[model samples]
Target: MTFFDEMKTTFKDIPRPEGEISTLEFLEASESLVKLFDLFGSSAFSVVQNDMKGNINKVSTKFLSDPINCNTLQKLILLEIKENGKKVATQGLLWLCRGLQFTANAMRKCIDNKDWELSKCFEKSYSETLTKYHSMLIRPVFKLAMKACPYRKDLFVKLGDDLNKVNEQLEDWVAGLEEIVDVIMKFFESGNYGKGL
Candidate 1:
């Protein structure tokens, strides 16, 4: 299927949550997000570790050594895109992963802030960016990933299991991030962020 078709297929499964959020909801969301972030970090590390035969470490090193303001994760996405000339699915997924990592880091910082109101504002921006990236990039790439690696009863089942775990972890992270964003929006709407602590 074409990228557009794949994106449509992907979106069909995602529920579009609507309506306003409250401060209690936002706090709960943030807590869940923090837990997801921790889980995502571990999952990401596992992927890197499993790449013993691959060049993820080299790519990571190059990214860290680069003078750009962007982090190593961002550089990894760029490297993947550049290297995966014909692997559109891999390229797309890498970019989406980069966006996830970026959002996770941003949320971590926001959650650390002493000023709840400012943190909520920052979270709002991060959530908006994440939503755009997920819809425009992640869905199609994910389709590509599944297509590239068709399920088979082969000896390399372990590899497939690892990939599945990574994918599952990513989905969980996205869900947690969305929850936090919903709460942040509610906090702003209720003017709770502006109130004295």
Candidate 2:
């Protein structure tokens, strides 16, 4: 399998017990993940944007939902990188980061400025859901992004920070961040932690 596949397997299988993953090993793995996600992000956004240039609501509900169709776009990104050059790959990935930052900022604005309870509730729900399901997904992505976007400290930090914000919002969001290797630790019962992973 390719590195991304290796990553998927690593992501799916829980991290080892007790011992910490070597910081260097983690950093290298993080680089690959960032590069790949960047690639995935650029292509996916481009395709979706072009396909729905005039219909953004449709785009969100259709192409960009969670557990979305990014899988295929991800593969395309990896394949292109494998076949092309690193420069091309990096460019694509950078674009992806920009897109993510834009969306995240917009989401933040919407969260802060709500005219209705429903809007606030929707923001709360989305944040909680992603915070619940996506800690595993977002951490490595952030680590990778940090490596990739060294100059853009704000974006990297903000994105990384987001992985933790939801649980804080819910209080349950750490009442989370307390799991074994899991980013958000699920509270099962007293003294027993259930991992969101």
Candidate 3:
């Protein structure tokens, strides 16, 4: 089976009808995505993995506190805002979405440009998705992780023996993730939930 197939919660399985993503499912999928960093086989990616994991845990903790009200991502943030007037989980979700976007964009670049190495794809995606949000010190750290990415072919081969099948699954997975990211970004922007975040 391909890596996507093996994932307990691929983006495809996350329910996002009308752009309202299920809270627990989305967190589960984000947790699964963090595992992808392991394929790089470098300590540098631990920074990326841990960042994503921390945000996922923040959101998960909030959701677990009140699953009935926080069933959907939007509701979770809105409820948090109403009760605490704080944006802890909201900010976490914003950064988590950005991280997912970075990963999706990098994978999309890999699918679009066969000549680019994984490092190049990651760097390009990082610039496009996360660069503006990162401070100078943080930017260099993420850059180091991007530069430490595994070779393209080596990573894909580890996914599955069939390159074509792996690419197809990856494309679908990235597409699903991109759609959800776009939805959350727009939601945050429209509601001004990301203000000062």
- What candidate 1 gets wrong by more than 4 Å, as runs, is 1-36, 39-85, 88-97, 104-113, 117-125, 136-197
Model 3: per-residue Cα lDDT over 7-75, one tens digit each? 888787888756699998898889889998887899999999999999998899899999999999999
Give the Cα error of residue 19 in candidate 2, in Å.
Answer: 16
Please state every model's RMSD to the true fold in angstroms: 19.2, 18.6, 1.1
lDDT of 1 at 102: 45
Arranged by lDDT with the best first, the candidates are 3, 1, 2
Top candidate (TM-score): 3
Q: What is the lDDT of residue 12 in candidate 1?
A: 17
Q: Return the clash pairs for model 1, or none.
A: none
Q: Give lDDT per model, in order.
A: 0.35, 0.31, 0.91
Tens digit of per-residue lDDT, candidate 1, span 43-70: 4333322322132333334444443521
- Please report the candidate that would top lDDT against the real structure: 3
List model 2 lDDT by residue over 1-197, tens digit each.
22233342222233433332222222233333334334333343333233222222322222233222222223223343455544232233323333333333333443445443322432443354333433576544433322332222233343345534532342321121122213211112222321121
Worst 10 residues of 2 by lDDT: 172-181
Displacement of residue 47 (Cα, Å) in model 3 is: 0.6
Question: Residue 121 CA error for candidate 3 (Å)?
Answer: 0.5
Residue 115 displacement in candidate 2 (angstroms): 2.2
